[model samples]
Target: MSYVVTVERVEEQPAAVVHGRVDVDDLPEFLGRAFGDVLRTLATQHLHPVGPPFGRYQVDGDVFEVEAGFPCDGVPTPVGDVEPCTLPGGEVATTLHTGDYQRIGAAYQAVAEWMGEHHWQIAAAPWESYVDDPTVLEPRTIVRFPARRAS
Candidate 1:
């Protein structure tokens, strides 16, 4: 699918997150388990999600150090591996992807190309917010790359 990348300001968001270093091939399972753990923890604690599930990825050679969770009201107590955290707020290059998760990389590539063209420097780990339920139909995800004008 084609993506229209755009730059926009994002506000700080509080979340419950789980971090782990996972191989690219194992990312799906890792994210699944991580989100499940977070959701369960929130339910057990009577915490409600304020937004959809989100994931941040930091590439390190062949593996990706990832943090996955859902945005929620003020941080809930740490439950096992899920911890309280915040998704940074600032300018970001973003695009929406409507399709399977396997094809989401194209959206990221589009954002990277846009960043390059605009001379924007990536300031933090990129993240993807799942906007639709994957089990029902084609999912919609917003891919975001935190950035700033090159100095």
Candidate 2:
């Protein structure tokens, strides 16, 4: 599928994040537990998604950390005992990807290729936003990377 590539200035987002390197294969299951179940449970209590779940962060040591489940409109409770925090905003190179986790690298590579072709440099770690819940469907996710406007 084709992705509508563009740059967006995201505001500071309040969310809860987990930091750890999981098996690439378990990324989906992990996300469901970390995001879907968390959000679904929150929504039931009237907590709705304020923004998208951003993740797939790869640090220098290959640390795959994720900050997901944004603040909702309802009262924050101890449903799953997960607290919320804010995620700072910046310009990002966002795109969507289909299929399984293995193919994700290709999608990321595609983004890098695009950036190179356009003379844009990535300014921060890449992040993935869980658009579709992997618990019910294939591993479809949107990849976003913070970047500065190339001169």
Candidate 3:
């Protein structure tokens, strides 16, 4: 349960998301295919691993966000390539997870439970910050869920 503090801005993003119900059991295969698809499309565009994508945030059902990034300077490799958009920075609740994307759900559950205890309302969608090369590392991601103390 390692965690780090960070500040990120959410920019105007139109990246294509692999929308589906992804459980711990389905991560590896899904990530492999998703990254591969994103990379293949973005040939000249280098796919940077911001962090491992795991965990679940219930915006409308449990939505799971995954890794890989396409910065503003980075050319749009795929049709759905998302540029670094505007992200509102403030006090955020975050946690880090190392290895096995399947176990990410527990991390999300942990954060949600922690929020409950602290009386915080989830303000936005949960996002995973990739910290390594998905093509290289075993996989490590920072799960951040925006929150505000409940009134």
Candidate 4:
């Protein structure tokens, strides 16, 4: 599917997250568990979430170092592996994908293609913020890559 990539400035958002180095095959389960942990942490600390859950990934071979959590209104007291972290704020090349999670890679591909054609250099690990419930037939997911124009 084709995507219309946009460059937009986003503010850094505080989040409570659980971090892990997970094999690709186990990512789904890991993210589910991590998200649950984050919610529990927020509840224990009486914090409210601000937005949809997100998973930031740094991939190496088939293993990924993942930070999975929900954006929160205020920083929460650390709970076990769930702690506070800030999502990077800056310009990002992004596109929305609406379909199965398995095909979300195409959204990333489209963003990368747009970035390459525009001489935008990736400034950090890319991430995806899921914007709708997975139970929906065509849920929207925003694929984002932090970037800067290359000299």
Candidate 5:
């Protein structure tokens, strides 16, 4: 799939989050649990999601630490494994990927290449916004990386 990378400013967003460390093979299960708990909590609290679900990844070889959740209005009270948090936003390099989730790493690589070509530096952990339901025939996602000009 083709992707266009761009730099954009984003505002801080509130979300229900669950953090954990898991291997790439376990990502789907981790996301399911994290998003499920958050969605369930939101329903019980009458809170609605304001945007797509996302996962911030701090990658370490085959295993990674991830914080998964959905952006929502003001923070909801913590419930079960879900906690209230904010996705700090600023200048970011982002690109939309349309295909299977297994190919997402290519999107990340594309963004990193874009950053390098543009002399930008990654400022924080990268994240992926799930723009469509995973069960769809073609899943769409926006991979984002907080970035700034290289010193």
Candidate 6:
């Protein structure tokens, strides 16, 4: 899998989010619950997702702190574990990854290498946009990192 990382500007997006701290091996189940709850909250509040589901992750030891949700048309009323948040607007280093999620680390590595070669620094936490359905034979995800000049 080869990635062509590029820099582009993104607009801030309102979202209904659910944050969780779970074992790395349990992330998928956690994301399922989070996304489902967020969707339910959106429906109840009459807010709609503007784009695909997205998640931001940070790993520590064997656990991951994940913030998962959807880029929605409007901020949702906080309900259950869902709360309103914004996907920050700024220039980003991004690339699309096509393959199994198990090998997605390669895509992140590609973005890091590309950024190092271009002298860019990640200025905020990175995220993944779940762009394709799970049933798709080749699932695609967009990986992005908010960025700034190295110095």
Comparing 3 and 4 on TM-score, the stronger one: 4
* Best first by TM-score, ranked: 6, 4, 5, 1, 2, 3
- Candidate 5 overall Cα lDDT vs. reference? 0.91
Candidate 3, residues 1-151, lDDT tens digits: the string is 5444343344433232333446545666766666555545545455443323332333434543444333233335336533233233555678777776567677777777877777887887776665665565567767777888899
lDDT at position 150, candidate 1? 92
Report lDDT (Cα) of residue 142, candidate 6.
97
- Candidate 3 weakest lDDT stretch, 10 residues: 49-58
- Clash pairs, model 5 backbone: none
What's model 5's lDDT at 141? 96
What is candidate 2's CA lDDT for residue 88?
A: 49
| Residue range 1-151, candidate 4, lDDT tens digits | 8899999999988999999999988988998899999998898888988989999988799898999999998987887899899878999999999998989888888999899999998998888998997789899999889999989
lDDT of 1 by residue, 1-151 (tens): 7789889998988899999999999998998999999999999988889989999887899899999999987778997999999888999899999988878889988899889988998898889999987775788999989899997
lDDT of candidates 1 onward, in order: 0.90, 0.65, 0.54, 0.91, 0.91, 0.91
Q: Report RMSD (Å) for each prediction in the order shown.
A: 1.8, 3.9, 5.4, 1.4, 1.5, 1.0
Q: In terms of TM-score, which candidate is stronger, 1 or 4?
A: 4
Most lDDT-accurate candidate? 6
Best by TM-score: 6
Worst 10 residues of 6 by lDDT: 71-80
Model 1 pairs whose backbones collide: none
lDDT per residue as tens, model 2, 50-113 = 7567664554444455554554544456555455555547877778887765667777887787
Residue-level lDDT tens digits of model 6 in 1-151: 8899999999999998999899978888898899999989999888898999999989888888899999899878888799999998999999999978888889989998899999999889999999997678899999999999998
Question: Per-residue lDDT for 135 in model 5?
Answer: 94
